[model samples]
Target: MVSKTIQTASPYLEGVYQPVLEEITARDLTVMGEIPRDLNGLFAHNGANPRFPPGAGHSWFDGDGMVHGIELNDGDAIFRSRFIKTQGLAEDLKAGEATYVGSLAMPGQGKRHKNVANTDLVYHSGKFLALWWEGGTPHELTLPDLETRGTFDYQNTLTGGLTSHSKLDPRTGELFFISWAPKPPFLNIGVASEDGRITRFSEVPLPGPRVQHDMALSDRYIGVFDFPLMMDFKRPDQKALGFVLDDETPARIALVDRKDESAAIKWFDIKPCFMWHISSAWDEGYEFVLVGARLDGATRHTKSGAILDDLPLVDGEHRFDSHPYMWRLNTRTGAVTERQLDDSFVEFPRVNDHHICSGARYSYMARIDINQPTLEAQGIYKYDLATGSRTDLKLPMHHIASEMSFAPRDGAKREDDGYLIGFVTDKQRMTSEFWITPADSIEDGPVARIKLPQRVPPKFHGRWVDAEAFRTA
Candidate 1:
């Protein structure tokens, strides 16, 4: 019998983080409101769900990858979920226990374990790619049903692995991604065609091993981030992912020309901070605009060993240092100006899929409420970049929502003419619900809420695969 000691000790391993026992498929789910007839696609979320209780020092991010999805067709919803079937998960199942430690616990210690593939999911070339933030090969999954296909290496064309936060160009149907390793030529950038073919792959060397999470893109250039937070694999005492924030290393952005892969990459120096995700970026005249959530200091480690300390404390007494900010870089004068756009605590910023790599009028993000004790978000916030206005769709107390993904309507004309889709977890009831809200009217709440069969644990990122995306693939 499996031991229950670990599950009872860690807060993350209990409650919603507790793993579900079986795969399920349920049809005709209960819906709170009318589902839009035009909203036809699959809302899929990727998260970690450990089958066995994790070992000591395991973080919430250390669990195995499980994908939970809901398919919408002609106003009806069908819910399904499955494990990612990675090599590591296979071994764990065979042993009837967890054999490998997680990134936060073991870091470089467990080199033989399988890549977990648990961070984010993207649909490109009519297939879904499961990704991890710390250098993992992409795992492919079929659309609609989300059946696991296998690992994708672009026909073995990729030298290094892929990053979790790859940028997809909606205008050209090109996928722009970056990867890093612990050696020289440690960083690489590549672009894949719409049909999942490697078109342009190049090595962009960085100073050392740095944690490059997300990249920003415009019509002409792609932005690669090199922040101070990095890993030192050679450190003898290093633990928990080997990440250390070096104040001496300044933050920089490398702008690579998309049209000319061999063009000299321009480097721009910015303030020293850490940004995990980028909402959007675009070029106007000679200035480039980049917007994302920024943290002035490392909040991962607090004086106390509380897991919620990593989150922005919002008790009205302790102000949050992490918030959304906009950075304007002038290419002509080498001048960079940054200003905070919102005071409220927010993260996982996403723009309309149709407006990526270009100017977007609206941005959607998960908002952390002051009343919540955990790090999970309590609501969704929609921000208008043009007027500097914000509207929130607050949830009931203790209810948590995932990162929002904007799905554009068919033959949609305006940028905001789409629906925002995400998963909401009711901790009190130990249930989950898939929600859909019109992008332009987020303040009005979800238009439809389909109850899910199982409680999906807190996850990192997800995507909406339209029916047409499969037809074209």
Candidate 2:
């Protein structure tokens, strides 16, 4: 029940002493039920030695729900954002290969340490760049191989409290991110120019800890939002269960001119808003941004005294649950719209012109609006903007879907209609599901659904590899 793929280059903690592996019997470690139920069960059995683990810090890691995508370059260079684990404290540190000990303190002790899993990393321009949340700082590694580089933190201090999600602009080769602080409470949509400089960092006043999740960019402007109250680090004691029982906070979409950084960012008044993964595309008349928010709380079925109770709760009686909705954002007039699907979802969203695509859980569709909630199906769903129509393909109950991408059709660029590609799982058979669907429409169903020979467990995100690029290690 341990991971075999992860290997270190130099001497790690395993070198300091004889590394011992033991089976976790008696379930001493408290399970907060953060990971998806199906994924949690698989990890418990298969035991993943992911590059980064949750409960630690935040980074775009390769584990379940962690967003990682292939940044198309010389062929396909897979890029993932994750918090690199290191041994020792601030002092007494020697850099080399070290076995990652995720927990600094023992389980029984009150101070249970977690690894850093909140940041995002990218491998581009012959270097690995890491972005952390705390300071919105950037850390770079020139070595192509990850192990030899050794772990490091950001050198620059982010002006705001926390740096949320970051996206790379393909056209300009720049980076866009949001910087905000909960204490003083202000948000800014920043642009990191090609020279690795903060070209335009504009601050906008907003309420405390809106905690921007994902953003979409069009030719004219970048659309951002204040996410739902369901997930917030502000009050760890705040109950997630209550947030799910009934939607508490609403999501709002804001527009900012891509060219005019000096102009005050315009706020669009959209209603019932709670989205997670987002992407954007543009046409002549208007710009379209794909956003996945939520229509309702997660469907839960807690036993009278279930194992969930044993796990450490994030806050008061908060059971682990999430629901993300996919919508289209119109920046010109500032209108958010989407087709009404009976089910709820929580996956990243993408757009292919008039068509919007996203990964989904089928169980969400099974729940009757009038009936009580329970765990069931998890699949992929596609929505059309012009028709306000939806198509559902049921995968399985426990399939943990992380992210989705749309590959260019034929030799067309991202601007044109492309094939929709998604990473999915069939945990029951320990199989990987990689399917390609037509971008123009899914009414005819997925063009081709290929199940990989090896089990891919579940993952966070993926990027499309342009055909012309030369991608070899």
Tell me, by lDDT, which candidate is best: 1
Model 2: number of backbone collisions? 47
- Report, for every candidate in turn, its global Cα lDDT versus the true structure: 0.78, 0.39
TM-score of every candidate? 0.91, 0.57
> How many collisions between residues are there in candidate 1?
0
Q: Evaluate model 2: give its TM-score.
A: 0.57
Residue-wise C-alpha lDDT for candidate 1, range 33-67, written one tens digit per residue: 98998888787888878877765335566678888
> Residue by residue across 263-329, what tens digits does model 2's lDDT show?
7776655554444444443333564544443433321212221223332222223332334344556
